[model samples]
Target: MNLIEQLKTILSEEQVTTNDVILEQHSHDESYHTPHLPDVVVFPNTTEEVSKVLQFANDNKIPVVPFGLGSSLEGHVVPEYGGISLDMSQMNQVLEIRNQDFLVRVQPGVTRTQVNKELNKHGLFFSVDPGADATLGGMAATNASGTTSVRYGIMRDQVRDLEVVLADGTVIHTGGLSAKSSSGLHLNGLMVGSEGTLGIITELTLRVFGIPEKITAARATFPTIQNAVDAVVAVMSAGIPMARIELVDTRSIQQVNTSLETTFEEAPTLFLEFHGSEAALQYDVAFTQDILKDYNCMNFAFEQDSKARNALWELRHNLAYSFIHSAPGKKLMVTDASVPINELPSAILHSRAKIEEMNLDAAIVGHVGDGNYHVLMMIDLSNPYEIEQAKILNEHIVNFALSKGGTCTGEHGVGIGKAKYQALEHGAAYEVMKSIKKTLDPNNILNPGKIFRDINE
Candidate 1:
């Protein structure tokens, strides 16, 4: 039987397709990276089906790239070497909610928003909000973090256990349900950020948090980008427990105001959120206000109304879309670089300078609380000059961050876009990663050309 026929036997015929539209949909993610279509797309509805598919692919030496919602900023889901695009959406289900254990067991296809909706009923919530309603499997693969990462930690921290299917069809549990462990080699850490290079994630067990008694959101405007970033440093140094602290530069604020039709101050601003008891939030807000004054904070506004608070975050989360909307017929190339807390001010300033020097249409924004920032650049993909300039700016920003002991990618995984920097960022550790990849996937049939340029290389 042919590949499609063979896959149909594992899944229902309706679950396999080679339609042009379906292939196009699975070809790329929300990234500027070049896309490639898989020869066939397969939707596995269960862990056993996934295992069978992998077992067949391993024996035949065919590449299998897992697909989520395709909301990834990097080209993590692109089928660089066409074979099988494993769509996990069919398996999406909130399998179990261990409310007493503060954990939720879910299939790989469940989205963060979907999980939260179910968790809300139990007065619990998942904290890793990566702006997009990304699938839990994809989030775990990339080790994604967002505004809340400053306090709650990243995706890896929330993952209690993972039911993964290896390249050769062997199933393994990376970690157990215990709160902590020193039992083995820490496979959970290895698989969480592996980006589908080592294995395919079939299911996940994640830690969840109870709804806070009170949640307050505030925005603080600053005279300059440096001042705003400095204020972030001050607030973090003060040990204020902030649920979210995001920085939006003047250009980005302008875009937000223009797009959302809201009269926000056109200055470098910090969007802050605090979660705690009503009395505790009041004290933290007061203390945070006092500290903001030291950094020339122009205006400090408290968004007490829940509707207004949601609007505020909506504006922040939609900042990227605003840039995209403003620039028609252009693609966005975002640079994700994270630096040490103390180096954030200079790092952001340097990025702003580079953007100006290149005269590119870009904006500065970040989850500044954790020293990670992104430069959103809109470039004409068809124009070679524009693409080259964007690439140069990305290299400059990444090199600067590396110099300061930061990472080329803070939350976005090392997909094709950031693969070139793997050796530079990890050094001798890069070799160790390649060894692990080879050991797990000898045929290099799983998500080829990711993490490293090629497993052999």
Candidate 2:
């Protein structure tokens, strides 16, 4: 029997879908890469069902793509090759909350916000807050980080353990709750950012943190992007222990003001947050203001009330949407790259020059704490010239970042868009990755044509 018939025999008909509409919807993610519909889409409610499906696909030499809510910036979920798309949405369940250990166990489909809501009841919270309400599985797959990452670290840091299913449908647990260990191979680290090319994640146990006794947010404005980034570097260098440090260029500030229907200065801005006891947070914010003044900051203000802080951050968090609102019928093209702290000034300036040279409309924003920033370019994809210009500009940006001991992609994984540049960036390390992929997935049926092509073949 064919794979579909065999799968239907094992799972309920309602769980398996061959309908074209569903297939098309499951094909691509929130990326500009071309999409190809999967041959079938299946929603598995349990780990056993997922393993069974994987075993069937392995037997049939069918590719399996693990899909979340399809909010990925890269083409991670696009099923370029016809095969089974494993939708993990139905696996959205919070299995347990270990409040004492400051940890939580959840099915792969649980989202960051969902976990936060549950943890709030215990006066605890998960730190990894990628702006989008992305699934835990998707966040793990991409090693996603966001504004709060400056303080709490990335998604990988929060994950204490993962229940992974191998390409052959064998189950394995990666790590444990021990705070530190010189254990066996670092399987947890390996699985956290594998992008589903290595194994499928079934369950995740993540570390959490106690809610801060006090939290404060600030909005600081600078005359230019350089001043803003310089102040960010100074703050970090001074060991301020900021919970969040984000830079929004003047252009982005203007866009946000228009898009959000609020009036703010049309100058480069910094959104800062501090979390700690009342005494410590007070010292941090006061010192931060002094540091910004050294950089010639024009206007600086902070919000301590939770409601005001939420409104302030809500504006900063939705910077991506500002691009969408600015250009109603355009697709948003984002480039996330990181450079050395000192090199950031030159990098940002060069990008601005490129935008002007190309006569393009774009804005720059970044998690400046880590020297990671994105160039959000609104493009009318229908225009051939505009598409070509974007490609050229993006290529230049990636090359510049690499030249400065930086990566072509910071948060976005190598999902087809950046695949071609892997060899150029990794050199000898690229071959090692290919070898690893081959050892883990000999058939190349899992997320094929990504990261590295089969070199032996």
Candidate 3:
């Protein structure tokens, strides 16, 4: 039988498709990276089905790229050397909710928003929100982090265990339900950020948090980007337990105001959130305000009303879309980098300078609390000159962060876009990673051309 026919036997015929529209949908993610269509797409509904599909693919030496919602900023799901695009959406289910243990078990296809909606019934939430309603499995695959990551930790921290299917169809559990362990090698950490290169995650057990008694959101504007970033350093230095601290530069705010029709101050702004008891939140807000005063804060206000607080975050979360909306017929190349808190100011300033020097239209925004920032650069993909300039600016920003002992990508995984930097970023460690990849996937039939490029290329 042919590939499509063979896959249909593993899944129902309705679950396998070669429709042009479906192929197009699976070809790319929300990235500027080039896309390639898979020869066929398969939707497996159970762990056994996934195992069977992988067994067949491994025996035949066919590449299989597991796909989620395709909301990734990098081209993590592009199916570069496509044979099968394994769509996990059909398996999405909240299998179990362990409220007493603050844990949840879910299939690989569950999304962050979907998980939170179910968790909210028990006064719990999944905190590693990466701007998109990304699938929990994809979030784990990328080790994604967002605004809350500064306080709650990243995706790897929340993952308690994973039910993974290896390239050769062997099933393994990377961790357990215990709060901590030293039993064996740390496979959970390895698989969480492997980007589907080593294996496919069939299910996940994640840690969740109870809803706080009180929540407060605040916004502060500064005279300049330097002052706003300095204020972030000050707030972190004070050891204030901030749930979220995001920085939006003046250009980004302008785009937001223009796109959303809100009258936010056109200055560098810090969006802050705190979660705790009412008294504790009040004290933290007051203390944070006092620290901002020393950094030339122009305006500081606490959003007390729930609607207003939500609205404030809505604007911040939609900043990237605003930039996209403003620039018609252009693609976005977002550069992610992280430095130590002390080096954040220089890193951000250097990024802003490079953007200006290249004469490109870009904006600086980030989850500044954890020293990670992104430059949203709009580019005309068809224009070679524009693409080259964007690349140059990105290299400058990444090189600067690397010099300061930061990462090429803080949250966005090393998909095709950042693959070139893996050797530079990891040095001798890169060779170790290559050995691991080879050992697990000898045929290179799983998400080829991700995290590390072919030596010849």
Ranking according to lDDT, highest score first: 1, 3, 2
Q: How does residue 140 of candidate 1 score in lDDT?
A: 98
Candidate No. with top lDDT: 1
- The TM-score obtained by model 2 is 0.98
TM-score of each: 0.99, 0.98, 0.99
lDDT of 1: 0.93
Candidate 2 lDDT over 1-457, as tens digits, reads 7778888987888999999889989988877778889989999999888888888888778989999999888789998887989999999999999999888999999988998999999999989877889999999988999899888998889989999988888888999887778989889898887899998999999999999999999899998888888898899989999999998888888888788878999999899999999999889989999999999999998798999999988888798887887787788888888898888889988998999998988889888788888998888889888888888998999999999999998888888888878889999998888888889888777777666654456
Cα RMSD (Å) between model 3 and the true structure? Answer: 0.9
CA displacement after TM-score superposition, residue 62 of candidate 1 (Å)? 0.6
When 2 and 3 are scored with lDDT, the better candidate is 3
| Candidate 1 global Cα RMSD | 0.8
Count clashing residue pairs per candidate: 0, 0, 0
Per-candidate RMSD vs. true structure? 0.8, 1.3, 0.9
Writing each residue's lDDT as its tens digit, candidate 3 over 1-457 gives 8898888888899999999999999999989999899999999999999999999999999999999999888899999888999999988999999999999999999999999999999999999979888999999999999999999999999999999999999999999999999899999999999999999999999999999999999899999899999999999999999999999999998898789888889999999999999999989999999999999999998898899998988888888888888889999889899999999999999898888877788999999999999999889999999999988988898899999999999999889999989899999999999999999988888898888677324
